[model samples]
Target: MALSQTGIRRWYLVHKWTSLICTAFLLLLCVTGLPLIFHHEIEELTGAHSSIEQVAGGGTASLDTMVEDAKRRAPAQVPGFLFWDSEKPLVAVVTASSLTDQQNIVIHYYDARSGAHVPAPPHDEGVMAFLLDLHKSLLMGLPGTLFLGLIGLIFAVAVVSGVVVYAPFMRKLAFGTVRKDRSPRVRSLDTHNMVGIVTLGWVMVVGLTGLILTMATPIALIWQIDELSEISAPYEGKPPPTRLASLDTAVAAARAAAPGGQKLSSVAWPGTMFSSKHHYMIAFSGETPLTERLIHPAFVDAETGRLTEIRDMPWYVKGLFLSVPLHFGDYGGMPLKIIWALLDIAAIVVLWTGLRLWFGRRRVPIEKRVEELRGGGVPEPAE
Candidate 1:
């Protein structure tokens, strides 16, 4: 729908300020996010990732052995979670001084079949990990994550408002036209509009997905307070199990509790935030990419090794899951990753050109700016 001149002017200001506010952060995100799209592939190429040796019988060793190996590796730390690597036949145990301690955690990897320690680089110590931290949270943890989410929200507004104001300007020009004969600033403005519009869908997807990811901490908290509390109601006032059941028995019970096709992905040990005090939380994933992101959880009694219950994640948590694959373009494999990279590069161009135009725009009244949008007044040459 077409907007009036007054509406266009309002939107132009919205676009202008929102862009100015988020362009720097958004640019940082785009730059850092580019490499992250190929995070797995990059890790594999660098030899930082370990390959799993397949056993002749195609049998995976018991989870108990893996946990023992991990404990031996990090004797001082307690096991927090045990998870399988999605792309390889490797299992990892995440250990820390305490379940709640988020710092100095260590990940111990083992060959799923042989149950031998696989020496791989620490997950938190690497260039890609550094870029990922900066991209996701600026190394400030939840606060930085939430801050970037707000920036994403502002970026969405900027994109929408940019489209709103661009409509009036484009009414007279062909779609995707960049006028070289015009002054430098005009040419840049045209290029910026063209590129922004072309990559509009992709930018919105990445931006909104990123915003959702930032809410992970809060979403987990809500789940714990709401659904988890309900799940734990039966065992109210019960202390965490003193002598836990066998890891293998708990895993077996959890597997039986889950559906036919879902495979075990991870297990949160009892007393961890992700698990109940009286139960071991086991998460399962589907075979396909999209399904893998959507987790299905099952609870096993920590002491008895008996199945407690299996349930699907809440809708909001599922939304968070769906956003992961969509945000990274990892679900569709190599082709999608390449396409995502190209769009990211184009977004960088759009941001760069927009910044240039802002810096070069003439000092003019609101009326003059509105006139420029109306495609009547000529913007002054790049200053």
Candidate 2:
């Protein structure tokens, strides 16, 4: 059945407004995301000194030594978190204030061998930070982040409506047909629908993933407030151990408590919440696709280093983890990433073409005319 002219016009209006509202923000995100997709490769090629692997010995370095070294470098600051880059064998002691007044800081590049502070190499902060900021709210902070998320939601709706309208638009024409000899508007509309529909699957996946990413913070907060608090309720008001427990012991405890098939790699500390106050948060990995990617965190008692719970992740948390690889195009290797990049480029072209079509339409609405100034002639639409 053919769509009436009115139906076609309504769909056109839907496409126009939806695309316009989200286009600028979506364009910025896609552009920034493109570079970030290759950040690791770019960083490697740039020869930036991000690791202390050459200097690190095989065994774990004493946290006390690393902490001392860090404090010596910045006496006025208190250590916030100690990050061990397992792959790089580098330890970073992060420092920040309890209050948000001061900008949180990380003094990176400490040589594990000499325990000496090393200067980080200069590269393109402009490009890297710009891309990151654009991806995470256009440097507009929380409000900007929320706005982009809303835009992403609209983008998803647009994708769906686009597919709906595509069927009707293509009903009279064969697949892959391009009406080069038709009216300019028809030709543009045909091009738009063809390109847009062809990339539907890819764009929809990316858009949905983007929406999930936007909700990450709120989801995490809910988990922390509800589940985590309940899980840790027994330990409430108990003083943390005066002696810092051995990370090795916590890791061992976590491994034993986790399902026999899995491997436990690292433990997050209490106050860190990545680690709970009462227990170490052990990250588990498995051999299978679903299991390997899913993180099964076991909460152990902080004072005793005894494992309390080993359980399956909540659906929302699982969704959050799964969404990351899909959104980043990292689950598949370089070939898939290349496909993702191409699809992203195609999205940009669609946005640009849509903008052009909109402006072209605006120039000469059939019912509207530009007023002529004194003795000045009115401009006419292109023949």
Q: Pick the candidate with the highest lDDT.
A: 1
Model 1 agreement with the true structure over 1-383: per-residue lDDT tens digits: 67788888889999999999999998999999999999988888654244664434334688888888888888999999988877677788899999877777998887777777888888888899899999999999889999998998899899989988888887777888888787777788889989999888888888898899999989988999988888889988877788989999998888877888888799998878887888889999998887888889898999999998999999999999999988999878799999999999999999999999788665545676687888633454434
Once fitted onto the true fold, the runs of candidate 2 whose alpha carbons sit more than 4 angstroms away are: 1-8, 46-93, 99-103, 107-126, 239-243, 260-266, 273-275, 287-292, 363-383
- Each model's lDDT comes to 0.85, 0.66
Report clashes for each candidate as comma-separated counts. Answer: 0, 2
Estimate the Cα RMSD of every predicted model relative to the unseen true structure: 2.0, 6.6
Cα lDDT for residue 9, model 1?
82
